[model samples]
Target: MKKLQLIGLILVLAISYQCKDAKKETQETMSDEVEATEVIVEEVVDVEIITFKMEPKSESMVQGEVTFTESDGMVSMSAVLSGLTEGEHAIHIHEKADCSSDDGKSTGGHWNPTHEPHGKWGAVEGYHKGDIGNFTADEEGNAVVEFETDQWCLGCDDENKNIVGKAVIVHQGVDDFTSQPSGAAGPRVSCTGIIN
Candidate 1:
């Protein structure tokens, strides 16, 4: 009778140990699957990228690369330029994508699809959709520009505010913002077409 009782106790202990091991294995597998799913989700987020290469007007080494990324309802722009005079410089989206001219005038005027007068960005009234303000160049002749806004879209989905097929112009002077027409931003130093 004592032997029988001992045998029953051993059997119970073995079953409990096996169940614990099985539960632990199942939990580890689930943890690994969750981690893999998180990685996959991170890899699948949608982001549209557009790039532009700016060519100097003439006798200027002012070259740059601008990248635009669209996510959600806003577009983010980043530009890295070199060989610029130290000070503020104006940047804007021009009416046409034509940058073939040596002086960059071939790109046409500032993009004013909304017919809004030239003014500071985020103003209560009178502001061109292309009025992107200015960027300051360091003493080393390098400039970095970055901003995010929902005022512009990648395509011409809303009226003509789209910038995909337009030209981005880098001016030699600062955009005074309050100046009539185009903020008197001066001549275009570099121009590039925005493309996907």
Candidate 2:
């Protein structure tokens, strides 16, 4: 009887030891899973992309061609505007380029690229992300503007968040960054929508 009792004690000890080993293994597995999840979250990858086109609004009395194309997350914009009276017009991305009218109500405000107020359309950081600036329509009412900047990258995850949903607005006058709001550009003469 004493032997039997001793055997019972030994069995219980073995079972307890086995349970401890299993618990340790389970903890290790959980740790591995957590690490894998973290890696996945850290590898956030997105290439910038944008597709846009603009047309002749009633306000767009000028015959201009604007095109935006994307490749490998990079975009290129080109504009050839004619029929603009001989002067500088503030050209930039508008809040929304619905172009439903000449009052420029269809299109919202300037692109304000850097989220800065309106300015003389040079290379002001916060002026207008889309503020390419002062395309002077000649006696023939024509102007061609072209340039590139990373300031606006579509499909970018976090940097430029409100790009895809914005419009391109052409103002009747130049943009002076210090100006209260619209750079006193009378109104929106043209607009284009950025689509997928």
Candidate 3:
């Protein structure tokens, strides 16, 4: 066993030496070739950056995130909601999509792209443009809401929805979908912007 281990170590060292030699050869090549190869590799990677944020509605703390390169698809999002009540509540993407400072109230109204009411998720005819639907919290009053939409742009060269300029609001109560514009979700407590 000792001899076999020693042999294995020697083989590994030999392979490593060969790799080092290849790296030196590449480094000695024309600088333009190296630069072109690097650019090609970068393009093959197809990188994307997703931004997200979470803001508590009341006293609860908020958490957000941004995910890139999941299963060869461009998907990124975030949620600023946590420690919510033990039930489902409406969470709409505000039309403004801007969550600057000041509690994000300047974000405007629910993202009603279709000009429809909220709470229309699974309905054959339900689902508002801004209506992503209610997120249910556990008994501990904590929920894991995420952000991901094709409406967003992944990079500077890609098309953008201009939603980064808007803000996301977590309603204390469910979306009533009664009134025109925003369902009575109450006030905006916490906020953060979707930045790269």
C-alpha TM-score for every candidate: 0.83, 0.61, 0.56
Q: Choose 2 or 3, whichever is better by TM-score.
A: 2
Q: Name the better of 1 and 2 by lDDT.
A: 1
Candidate 1 stretches greater than 4 Å from native:
1-44
Q: Which RMSD does model 2 reach against the true structure?
A: 11.9
Give the C-alpha miss distance for residue 129 in model 1, angstroms.
Answer: 1.1
Worst 10 residues of 3 by lDDT: 63-72
Candidate 3 residues lying further than 4 Å off, grouped into runs, are 1-44, 57-81, 97-103, 113-128, 146-149, 154-160
Location of the lowest summed lDDT over 10 successive residues in candidate 2: 44-53
- Tens digit per residue, CA lDDT, model 3, 1-196: 9999999999999999999999988777867798999998988777655556465545545444323332234444545445666787767767665665455577777665555545554456455556656677778776666755554443334323444444556766677765556667666655555445
lDDT of 1 by residue, 61-177 (tens): 789999988877788989999989999999998888899999998888888988888888888878877778899999998999998898778874785657877888899999988
Q: Which stretches of candidate 2 lie over 4 Å from their true place?
A: 1-53, 57-60, 71-74, 112-115, 120-125, 159-162
Whole-model alpha-carbon lDDT for candidate 1:
0.87
Best by lDDT: 1
Candidate models: Cα lDDT each: 0.87, 0.66, 0.60
Best by TM-score: 1
